[model samples]
Target: MKHARIGHQSIPRWAYLLFIVLAVFVLYRIFQHRAEVAKASQPPVRPVLVAKVITKDVPLYLDEIGTCSAYETVQVQAQVSGQIIARHFQDGADVKQGDLLFTIDPRQYQAALDQAQGQLGQVKAQLGLDRITLKRQQELRARNVTSPQDLDVAQGTVNSDEAKVKSAEAAVAAAQVNLDFCNIRSPINGRAGLRLVDVGNIVSGGNAGGGGAVLLTIQGLDPIYTDFTVAETDLALVRRYLGGPNVKVQTDLSDGSIPPRLGDLYFIDNAVQPGAGTVKARAITPNPDRALWPSEFVRVRFILDVLKDAQLVPSQAVQISQSGPFVFVVKPDNTVDLRPVKPGQHQEGDMTVIENGLKPGETIVITGQLALSPGAKVDPKPYDAGNPKSDRQVAAKGAM
Candidate 1:
């Protein structure tokens, strides 16, 4: 029985070729996806702003939070008690020494002075008459017309009257002083604050109470004092460099319109503060415009010395981490090396002094540090702080 001869179905060469092509295409796609992922994993070349580490003479300054204090603060008060008759000066006026500030009731003082003067005149007349009588008595005694006792009595009367004249003179002088005090004058050259006692108010004098009621508050403005502190640990360093010549202090006022003022360091506390571990320091600065006020907070920069040929870089290049301050240094091949640095004084122009871990003429990454890692390649661009457009562009990139 021939089973109708079993026959085998064969696949066409074109179909087999098609299958091979599909398998090869799927494998290629898998490998291509892998290759793309690997490429994506590698970091791209970053564009960064760079600056050269410069060697120049940099003024070393210590910055501290400080306060502007008046050189002298005076509470203007009356020396003699009286009713305030008039206010001579306006509130918050700039006053000079001996400037009349207020006037008390001078009528009573004037009357007292007049009475004292009259008393003094009366005493003088009595003394004059006594002298005449004493001379006549002495002549009589010499000529035996009067007894010795009588002459002695006349001389004693003359002496007693002379004593009375002296007493009256002192009283008159004291009265004049009281009258002068009725016109209160500024004791210091300063700017006056609000009027404490208005016209028609009866104020006590210095003799009335421990201190007279404060009529006005005045604070010296020019050559003002700025009080700041330095950490106790830095005392030695501060003292060492402070001894150098041309050391100046700069004060940053709260008002931005005014430039930083130059001052001289005049005082240092004898002892460090107990708990804070800081030492009080003071500077005297001329405030001709009265820009600084008493108790106004300010920033004080004490320039101890100028470091010559120091390595410096833009301040933004320095970054802080858990270890310490570090900076990304760009190499010649555009690769960045994360370098730990010892940052020193920061200049007013955004330049910082690097004490270590950097050298002069070395390029440092300043702006694009956010996109950097160790050994990563970067496209270094020169950072020009003067260019406003470049700043905007950098800011834009940072936001992205």
Candidate 2:
């Protein structure tokens, strides 16, 4: 009590008063600093707000890798052994079915055919003589003028000559077929590759390596096939979305970097592939200009089904916390609320479907999630300010 009334134990009054003021000022500074440090240490966690946008028909697509190939291909080879007499059609030229591709030397086949025909004539003449003798002998034997043994000999000779004639006829037929094969023709209408053999070169049967010569190759390129695969797990989706005839596909050229050509799907594999766990599919595209070449790697896309009037939100708008999928809904009072949502399929650009949560006209943080609190003041801007395209799509649906 004495020290409190007389500062500094009976010291000067001005000195005691100054010391008291200095102590009071020091205490005020400490209290102010503590208040500031507490505020900084417990800073608020911000929330990224996005709009619970209404989802409408969004163009969805299933993209995959694929390859292009000709509809049909044929390798032309010689069927009969002969010298390659002449070559027809230029390299890489489009040819029609039955077009003469090469002309093998027909002289050997013709000579064989002529020889068989000559043999047939000789056998026929001998049979004629035998038949005449047999008829005479049978007539005489009936009258007892010829021996039975003579009639039997004549009959046997006629039968032997007839057999020889039949054999000669078969040989002639085979020779004629071989002659026809000397004129090599295209089996199908397509583009031709190159002539592997020059004129006057010897070619054996089947061109069995064609004496180191391959005639040509032809490929059908008008309507081409583009093949791709989808995951086996998505079989249900393929059945659902691919049923529509309007379902479109496109193929990219040059490592999928180029723009894709519009095509339509026509084939699907019946079973899943074992090694890759994928199901194969094929699409046909008209290549009047030969834009899709044979064996070219391609990037493909299937236009997914169009969702009719679905509720869509930004992909970033949906956040996963301890609870589940949620969006920070900004109320009119600028306070944020955590909105639990059930999401559906995603669509083109940056929109997704809202299955069970969120309603129209609900504003949520699209960005700045790291700075949001439950009751913190929110400066809600348009959801697509930074992303103009998304903003346009959002604005098209009337989301600000």
Candidate 3:
């Protein structure tokens, strides 16, 4: 018997290809799932930069914006009216006290002086003649040759001549004073400003009301004054150490091209400004090089006291959370702990003064706190204060 023909059934090429693709996908998924499980089982060890908490003396200070002012400002004006014959100093020259600055025409004043002197001489001659006449009249009266009324007249004439002589002498003194006024001199040692009047320019004399054509302006630059203000809330603290030995001020230009100038606190306004709610204060700083100029803006650091043995840390080490400020402290086992801290003023060199909750010799994380949690292991690295890039990197991470 013929058996039923056995039919050969073959799978399609596309179907086999599909099966192989599915098997490969399943194997890949299995490997990926195992990798994820392994990753979840082990915690990541983060790398961080850290610094040691230090102890040092820090200044208790108030920072403020201030302006430089001349210790003395003078608007020089003519004291006697005349044509300016010559200028003794150039514009913007440095002058000492009694240095001649200008010369006015002195011809008229000299002529007036000569006339006054001539009048004085005439009066003196007349007084001498009258005195001789009085003596002769007294002799005649003694001989009974002249009347008493004549002698009295002679004495009155001599007295009148003496009065005239005194009047002439006063006029002569007045003329001499006017002559001296023709030469204008600097009253103080200072730097002169631009000349307002040129030679041959006639300037009017200063009046009793102190108004006149201002010839020049002079400003005293050495030992300049820096004017600043303190907030009303801080006034009490400033007043407590206003005149104390530890109280001092340091002024620096905003550009910081020049070094800071140390000074003494000079003045404090008695009352606060009504609108500003700040009390004005002044500091006298030595500016021997004349580096400080009038109306220049500067930064003022009013140092009240010094804190001895204060704990300090890198400013970037301090982190702010919802609770408050905290720092990540590294332990001996390379683990970190979150510590709450009371931070004080930020001092020079990017340092923060820790008023509470930190001790000297402790290590705190300065950077890489973004990836850390409490009790997390870390790959520690030393903080480099001198490296500016480290600060910028920390700032960027902290910002994130």
Best-performing candidate as measured by lDDT: 3
Off by over 4 Å in 2: 1-61, 207-213, 235-289, 302-400
lDDT of 3 by residue, 121-240 (tens): 999999999999999999999999999999999999999999999999999998998888899899888899999999999998774456767899999998899999999999888878
- lDDT per residue, candidate 2, 1-400, as tens digits? 8868777466777998999999999999999999999988764433233555774775457878788888899877778877887888898888889999899889988999999999999999999988999999999999999889999999999999999999999999989988998998998877887667788988767634444245778998878899999998778877887778558777777664555677788888899998999998998877776767888887787775666777878777777788888877788877787778997766556667788878876677766655555666565556654566664454333222
Candidate 1: residue pairs that collide? none
By summed lDDT, which 10 consecutive residues of candidate 3 come out lowest? 1-10
Clashing pairs in 3: none
Prediction RMSDs, each to the true structure: 10.0, 12.7, 11.3
* Least well predicted 10-residue stretch by lDDT in candidate 2: 391-400
Candidate with better lDDT, 2 vs 3: 3
Judged by lDDT against the true structure, how good is candidate 3? 0.91
Ranking of all predicted structures according to lDDT, beginning with the best and ending with the worst: 3, 1, 2
Which of 1 and 3 is ahead in lDDT?
Answer: 3
| Model 3 misplaced regions, further than 4 Å | 1-47, 121-169, 207-210, 377-381, 390-400
